[model samples]
Target: MDRRFANGTVNAAQTGSGPPLVLMHSLLSDRASFDRIVPTLSESFRVVVPELPGFGQSEAVSGGLAAVADRMAGAVDDLADGEDVIVLGNGYGGFVALQMAIRHPNIATRLVLADCGAAFSEPGREAFRAMAAASAAKGLAAITDVAMRRLFAPEFQQAHPDLMRDRREAFLKTDPGVFRAACEALAGLDLRPQLGQVKVPVLVVVGEYDEATPPPMSHELAAGLPQARLKIIAGCAHVPQLQAPQAFLSAVGDFLGRR
Candidate 1:
């Protein structure tokens, strides 16, 4: 089930057998972030969960997010084999998927952007710059808690101690250089102008309690896209698929199930 594409620059796990559905993980997380929902989704689609460039077994890419997006577009194209595929991205992955769709207009037939936005507010940009600086100066350890807080609310973290531990371990495995580079790219990123280029339908979903990207960001993303609908998963933060898998699935079911 493990496969390499784009000349082994991309690594992914494949399952099921039907229309292709690619799952891209967040910058703070790895491919495992989609573990909760993959099994069910695979039943209806050939699920391809890829580790974004510079994450897990995938090789890193330079030239900022656009370069990263282009690299992923190659991988998706290889996986799609001529047929259009569906791309679902979470958090940072959502940003990458959005850029990929923009740069490669025909790469995906539809998009599921979860907990991401076309542009971050000034304060949000400052946050990424701060994280990059802090991590570069002292390493990822210095901002581990901050990263975890952004991913999950304090209450949720407290309620799921074991899952928190697993998530923390996963975050620690991220390459520090890759983390800093992504942070810098996100800090300077603004994809709103390119939203018009994406002709595919998009399902923009966010957690009602998400603070990292927030609901307004998703609202703006949905409004900017040519064809997009917004959905808010109640009582969850970023990474709602991990926090509340059933609700997350319910939010995207209709869109994903459509022919």
Candidate 2:
């Protein structure tokens, strides 16, 4: 079922029972973002998929990356029962997960960052700014095409036309202001200098054809962290969990299961 902090700053979907495993969604996604893989993940651990502020049923909370991290850290604590837990984050969620590890050390016992990098390069920051500008000028409809292209490969887009339409509608429904604020946060974020502080084991997975955060970016992320390994899912784009579920599950399951 769903659980919300008394203050109402966080809302999460909790299931199963065992060592905690928290799954964080992408920027534009909700708790259901991990629905396809949750059953397998929950079989091994109590899985908590939290809908970050401004997404799904969760209410928006003010702040930048650090502030967002604090809210997510609180959710982690509420679910972990005082025990360190594994955190798996995709896209924007990955960014928040890194901030959690850096800002509130010891909260996460293991980290799996999917389709995300340590920091955005100059061009990447500009992309976020441009997206914010376009969205602000004409709402989410203006940027949905570009966002979709960046999130998926052309071949995949061509093959899954209906899914593309649904996702486009989903984007259009989100408040442009909230989406813009998130983009601005990404534009201003620079985590490269602090990667060394993340000592917990990390698994950095990137889609083979991710246009937004490419393999090179994931390589940079893996190289920066003190204890990190990289994995690339073939024939996949930005959303491996959706595009290559088996590969994604295998990578994450092996990492969490290994001694």
Candidate 3:
């Protein structure tokens, strides 16, 4: 069931019992990004998946990466009862996860970051600007293909037509203004310098063919952190939990085992 916490700043889906595990979603996606894997995760944890600010039922908050991290910390504080929890974030969620570790050091004891980078390359920044402008000008319907290209490998896109359609439908459902705002938020983000501040164990996973955050970015992120490792999921793209759940789960299982 969904629970309101942090004075309604977060609308979270909670299940199971054990050490808390918080899940955060990517841009253009909501809490449902983790839907397929939440049940499995919940078996071993108290899973708390929150709809990020400006997405799903969560209200949008002002400011950039640091501010968003603060809001996420609030959710963690309420859900974990001040106990540090494992935080798993994908894409945009990964950025927030890193920020939480940096800005709110006590919030997460371990972090699993999938398909996200510490910061965008110059070209990447331009791409985000272009995407935001496109969304602003023509709405999400006009950028479905653009989003699909970033979210999946070329082969996956060709083979999973039905899933691609569903993703497109989900994207269309999101408010364009929120999407644009998120893009802008990413455009101004650069967290590389502060990566060393995170004292928690971290696992950085990326799809082998992920076009958005790519493998090299994950390598850089893993190398920067004091306690981090990188895992690349073969035959997948941005959303490995959907495209290659078993591989993703195995990697996560191994990481959690060490912790």
Candidate 4:
């Protein structure tokens, strides 16, 4: 949980026991974001959930994509102890996961991307920048309404008011600069060309109701790699890990069990 990395002290939580599996949360979210799903995953594998730079107590990457990706890779490499790793990244963390796969395909023995967009979604990019800009100027409250409604499925919001409250508070907790740079960098990434080089098995999970990165996006990511299995979960939105834990776990667990 406490170690020095990227030339600074990194403070994050690590748990479970089995093969090491690195967990990264979505944008505006941190390691604690997996509090609900950890119990399930911890049963099968050693889970390393870190507070990504500027998301929680962690620091931000000083440079751009190269810098951030390198910092992430370094953190993993340092803490990994040279063991094979299964990476599970959700949303923005999925972007980082993809980069990790491309940057070090050998280490990422298995990769799982949940609701991540490969090619830039025009509206999504615009929305990300707009929200980042809003948060930078007027603060988080500027775009609170849209973020609350769009982050989850309609049915989810209605069924779980308490979760929505927690999510909102978490969003506010994110450092604006990291959020902005990450969003901007993701909006500009095009990994379609590099995915073919990845030799690791990949699992693509998408929420049926994910308007942000819909089934088409998952299909697109799944299409790029020769070893990817795509699954679309019903009644779930962007964050299926929390919105539909059982179904989500079933999909991911089944894949991990096999490998």
Question: Among these predicted structures, which one has the highest TM-score?
Answer: 1
Task: Show where candidate 2 strays beyond 4 Å.
Answer: none
Q: Which stretches of model 3 miss by more than 4 angstroms?
A: none
Among the numbered candidates, top lDDT falls to 1
lDDT of 1: 0.94
Report the Cα RMSD per candidate: 1.0, 1.6, 1.4, 1.9
Error of 1 at 187 (Å): 0.5
The Cα local distance difference test for each model comes to 0.94, 0.85, 0.86, 0.77
lDDT of 4: 0.77
Candidate 2 residues 185-217, lDDT tens each? 989988999999999999999999988888898
**In candidate 1, what residue range of length 10 has the lowest lDDT sum?**
250-259
Error of 4 at 143 (Å): 1.5
- Model 1 residue 87 CA deviation in Å: 0.2
User: Tens-digit lDDT track for model 4 on 25-50?
Assistant: 88855566678788877787777887
TM-score of each: 0.98, 0.95, 0.96, 0.93
User: In angstroms, what RMSD does candidate 1 have relative to the true structure?
Assistant: 1.0
- Per model, state how many residue pairs clash: 0, 0, 0, 0
TM-score of 1: 0.98
